[model samples]
Target: SQTIHQWPATLVQPVGSPLSLECTVEGTSNPNLYWYRQAAGRGLQLLFYSVGIGQISSEVPQNLSASRPQDRQFILSSKKLLLSDSGFYLCAWGGDTEAFFGQGTRLTVV
Candidate 1:
């Protein structure tokens, strides 16, 4: 069985601060990893994705960056967070057809 975990389910940060969020998967190897953000009433936007370790593709360029340091670990980081960076961040992994999402991390910037 495969499962994903994320920390600090909710966070409130001041604008212009740094941000780091981590996600890890268990019971899978070399699975495709993806980072997505969902805004209020908006569709999900892919931020980054990795096909393997040390291989990442950025779908959108903003105040965010992603890295894959291990086979099943993905990290999202921001050097200086902006007010617009606030949203629901999700980590997912799947194959050619389906993907599973984490509970998601809700970030609120003020």
Candidate 2:
């Protein structure tokens, strides 16, 4: 069975601090991985995606970055946090048409 794990579930961080969010998929190989952000009551926005290890594509110009360290692991990071960066972050993995999402992480910047 394939499963995705994304962490810290929820976070409260001070502004200007560094941030790291991790996601890892099990029982899958070379799956397409993506990082997304959903603002309160807004549609999902794709932040980054990777088709394979060391391959990443950014969908938006934001303070976040994504990386695929292993075939089934993805990480989202930021050098410095911003108030606008607070949102619900999701990690997903899928095949051509179907995707599986993690529980999601809610981050609040203060």
How many backbone clashes does every candidate have? 0, 0
Error of 1 at 11 (Å): 0.4
Model 2, 1-110: lDDT tens digits are: 99999998999999999999999999988999999999995899999999999999999898998889899999999999999999999999989998899999999999
Best by TM-score: 2
Candidate 1 residue lDDT tens string, 1-110? 99999877999999989999999999999999999999984799999999999999999778899999999999999998899999999999988899999889999999
- List the candidate 1 regions with Cα displacement exceeding 4 Å: none
Alpha carbon deviation, residue 43, candidate 2 (Å): 0.8
Q: How good is model 1 by TM-score?
A: 0.96
Q: lDDT (CA) for every model shown?
A: 0.93, 0.95
Clashing pairs in 1: none
